[model samples]
Target: MSAPGEKAASELPQRLWLNGRVLEGRKDFERALENASEQERPVLEFGLRWCSDEPEMVLHTSGSTGRPKEIRAKKICMAASARMTVRRLGLRAGDTALLCLPMDYIAGQMVVVRSMLAGLRLVARRPSRRPFEDLARAPDFAALVPLQVLSTLEHEAERSLLAATREVLIGGAAVDRALAARLASFPNRLWSSYGMTETLSHIALRPLSGPRAGVWYEPLEGVRVSSSPRGTLAVSAPAVGVSLIETNDLVVFEPGSDRFRVLGRTDNVIDSGGIKVPAEALEELIGTVLESPFAIAPLPDPELGNSVAIVVEGTPDLPLPDFRALLRGAGLSPYWKPRSAVFVERLPRTRTGKLDRTALREAARSAPGRFRRAL
Candidate 1:
């Protein structure tokens, strides 16, 4: 594979499908950008960047767990990442791929790159909860965040449009049990992606629907997975110029197989007294009892060192005691049970739509009076 900047502009994709129009070459792309609407500008701007003479592009981390930062990635590595996805998903040339994510993000960038490289037509849309609102036809493939998928499933029309898409990739956040259950019957192929900006997009995919659907995430071709000393995931994908990228996400492998299951972030764990609890695992159990959007957070405790608390979005429908009782009845161990609850109008999220744990912790600590004791 050619190094970054080594490949000339002539080697890049010459055709682009912006919205409903076809743009060819640098002149066509530049013309469209000059006359582009606010919604269309991001796509066009990124298109211009991709076609630039620069060898590297600036990308941002999602900042779900920490502060967001910029990282420079080789264009050649990105192209290799795009090709891996195209081959793994069987995306054919002339097929349509939807671009509904923020162009500044890696997911959106990869969609455009994949379309360009594979000769697939690109369909750009404004990023919104209802991405399929103005769609006139189904796309051959589409990429969406978990929140968008959940929103689409709520409405009949949008849900049908999503189901008609030949392939769908869901990422940016974990897919909860309730949402996964609803997707089990979809006729089309739906996958939950596991990756970050550092990996270009996703190095692994877990099928959300079909007979192949399961809890484990299977690494894509040219990708290898291993566990760190701390049990976190480590990846090595030479195809994307990644020799090894260690992650803070805790994972468990399938014994002898390369397949793995993400348990939760090691930093998100609550060390209460001498016992350690994974916040995500606790949240998954809590989700079965409470259907609302909520997160398991750790609160300071003098005796236990740290105590588990539930941060719920919007107003709690039931009384604090009643909510605690419901969780207790759900067969939770003493360690997993939340000692208190906090209610906010909306949970804090990063720009990429991931739970902002750092901000969430600040919220829980800033207002002690707001906490309602579970007892």
Candidate 2:
């Protein structure tokens, strides 16, 4: 419980709303702690710093781009993001929102922050076998990742829950053509947002509706976007904490517009026989050809410093010659295409549902003769 004087009206209480019933955070925490302790040690153990931190959120990068670094976003930034969202979506003070993502991440944290700031009721649920089962009634707003949306869409009742929401914010990873196509059929307002933990969540939102169903990054009032020498995206927003966050994300600016298309990460670039190859670009190419979830990465090579390899989760039996021909059809340079293709039952992912590059690299190395021949 917050100290008597410490409790502010703005402070989000634990038991805000659960289905139709309201549960208090402190009482719920005590019960949950007891229940969890009986079965095992705490699923999440936090430090004193986290408990006492004035900021509502402290998010860390997944280290996919580089080493995982801690980011401290003041509650003010969260409030600012909420305020922008409120204006953009025309949400009212008494509306409701359902939260499914983990609070440890920005997506979930923002829901709590927005609920507090807007004086809106928040419905909380433990991510379950069927997450929507916990929702007492339909909510006015909610945020979901691609995975959750796909999973919920597979079930009639779950899909009903999704359809009931007035607005749905989707992020965390790229939404493919298949998912996008399905979402297009729904009448609900689905927004594909772009942001990172450093940005205190999304600063740009594109409608996932008819005609406007493509990438559009409209910077918030306090935010700015620019490019670097390497054609990478750079973000400047007071709400982002840093003056300028130079990202490794590759982007191409539209000729007459501020919107840009995110190509992929600059760090994923590979050198094949003296040719510089962007692995992300190759992934896009392969995805276009194969129409499947695939990733292209660099394999250590003595001759070229780094050679290209392809990993696919589908159809291991697909012949290498046919796959090569697909790349050729796509007009990709020979060196930019994978030297070897390895089929895995499924690509391993992290807890946060991101590709585990370290695991992928190790998997590539362990494949017989693949890494050696690349070298």
Q: Pairing residues by index, what is the TM-score of model 1?
A: 0.93
Please write out the lDDT profile of model 1 over residues 1-375, one tens digit for every residue.
565545654466657776678877777879998789887888777777777777778999888887788989887778889888998899998899988898878998899888878888888788888899978888999999988998898888899999999999999999887788889889999999999999999999999899988889999999999999989999999878789989999999998999999999989989998888889988876676676788888889999999888887756444433444654677656667787787777788876678899999888777556445453
Record all residue pairs in model 1 with backbone atoms less than 3 Å apart, i.e. clashing. Answer: none
Over 4 Å off, model 2: 1-15, 18-57, 128-130, 133-138, 289-292, 318-321, 368-375
Q: After best superposition, candidate 2 residue 129: deviation in angstroms?
A: 8.0
lDDT of each: 0.84, 0.66
Candidate 2: how many backbone clashes? 4
| Candidate 2: residue 5 lDDT (0-100) | 36
Evaluated at residue 333, the lDDT of candidate 1 is 60
lDDT of 2 by residue, 115-165 (tens): 655766766666533567646567899888777887788788888988878
